[model samples]
Target chain A: MENFTPGASFLGGVLIGLSASLLLLCNGKIAGISGILGGLLRPVRDDTLWRVFFIAGLLAGGAILRLVSPQVFDIALTRSGEVFLLAGLLVGFGARLGSGCTSGHGVCGISRLSPRSLLATLIFMTAGIVTVYIVNTFFGGAL
Target chain B: MSTLVTSFLAGMLFAVGLGLSGMTQPAKVVGFLDLTGRWDPSLACVMLGAIAVHAPAYRLIRRRSAPIFAAAFAIPTRRDFDLRLVGGAALFGIGWGLGGFCPGPAITSLPSGHTAVLLFVPAMVAGMYLHTLVEGLQVRRSGIVHPETVSRSPTLPPSPALQYRHDA
Candidate 1:
């Protein structure tokens, strides 16, 4: 439809960063989705409820937001369902491999002045930049 | 469970922000990353929002004796930049430029079912694991001291579960 504004992206980043920092500050945990989801893959008996609740909350949040801000919602899935599923798997694996996801490292890690996080965040951002170029240029929209 | 609960709430909020900000779309993210060209300044706003909201929250949280989990705070303090750091950055740059998704936003948007992110995210994760494995092997092979391996101070001790909390 209309071109999205930079204001929204900035606000969104702020919200994401705030949410992540608040969680870490209060809960002493990194809000890395990969780690949380990975934990679900092979969860301990004591942990099942929390993880389930956490993921459920995530879904509820989206649905609620959609209802609250229909104009802002603008919901759209950019890729096929099959592709999305595959991406989810890779991200899950990457989060574990990296020891944390972007939220964990990019937000919380960097905020805390963790050297590993700074490096991780840098890498993560760089990867994101490169992926966009390749996709838009050589890969075509098929990617 | 506690950690999961907290993280879940955080993720939900994150998802809300992503949706509201139009970050769930690859075109949007890629647009923001196109600094040298069209130079979308929208992503900067996100960074500002995060920074503005987080400054105070961080102050309060850092004052705590320990986190709400079991043992301690997990803040890392490695200051030195090394090859691992540089190489990882390069790889991450390549992926992001190619795929239009990084680990954080990519994971947040998964529920929406974006196809390209589906591909980019896994590759991102694989890269992460690959980094870890390679790092381990490197450590074993050369014994070249990685500056990051050393811990300066013992991390804050973990505290017992506390009451529900939220700060923005």
Candidate 2:
């Protein structure tokens, strides 16, 4: 609520969409973060370099943003390190198992009107909402 | 070279969008996911904006025979709502709610040098690699033929067994 900026969010969404389109149009790839990063964990030789560069580009994005508008990034977390690790593990496993996440399933897949992505987006969001509710209402805001 | 450049640019652009959209901030993401509380609807705009541009662009792009760099479009074309898809997404939602960081924003925010991301990314990677390794073993255990392990590169390869869903 304190930092909500609808206009910027919408603009950023367009940027994200443009990026996804760029990948599909040019390299025939989805701009899914988990999929892209997941590929690196396995490290296929021919497919590795492009992923590395893409990740490098991601790092560069943060760097550029920091240099230009540091306030745009507020990477704060209320959760403990152990919880983050657990969450990260689940995210990794789930995304791999599920095959996509917010960007991939929620944005790109759904845009194509893929029923699978729609189901994914709905399920994940519902799960997320429920989890947040549990954490806030029971666990004192973080688990 | 074109592949590298385009991929890199796309990655950068995506990260920038995530940052600007407030997706990099765990609190903001949590706000969006927390529907009952002081729910923030900014992420809705982000999703709408992304789909508005991407869906149409995707439909248009499919008209092309092949991408400029790749031999053929390397997109997923599977259509199924199998248990794995539902179960995996359910798990991911728990993680997203718990940590407020999906893989993209989590990685994208690393350069900010936050402690949470520092801890989270490595663990996420470990989980990802571990899942594939375990699943790979399970496939072999079930007497299924070895799945295609070398058709793609080190970055996210297609999940042949567990996930056949098209690239979202």
Best by DockQ: 2
Clashes of 2: 8
State the iRMSD of every prediction, in order shown.
Answer: 5.5, 1.3
TM-score of chain A of each: 0.76, 0.91
The reply for model 1, stretches above 4 Å from the true place, is: A1-4, A42-49, A69-94, A139-142, B1-8, B68-71, B77-95, B103-168
| Segments of candidate 2 deviating more than 4 angstroms | A1-3, B147-167
Worst 10 residues of 1 chain B by lDDT: B159-168
* lDDT (Cα, tens digit) per residue for candidate 2, span A1-143: 66568999999999999999998899888888888888776665577788888898988898888888777667555788899999999999999889889988999889888788899999999999999999999987866
Q: How well is candidate 1 docked (DockQ)?
A: 0.33
Displacement of residue A47 (Cα, Å) in model 2 is 2.1
TM-score of each: 0.67, 0.93
TM-score, cand. 1: 0.67
lDDT of 1 by residue, B5-85 (tens): 676777678778766666655556567666544556565566557656665676678788887663565453345555544
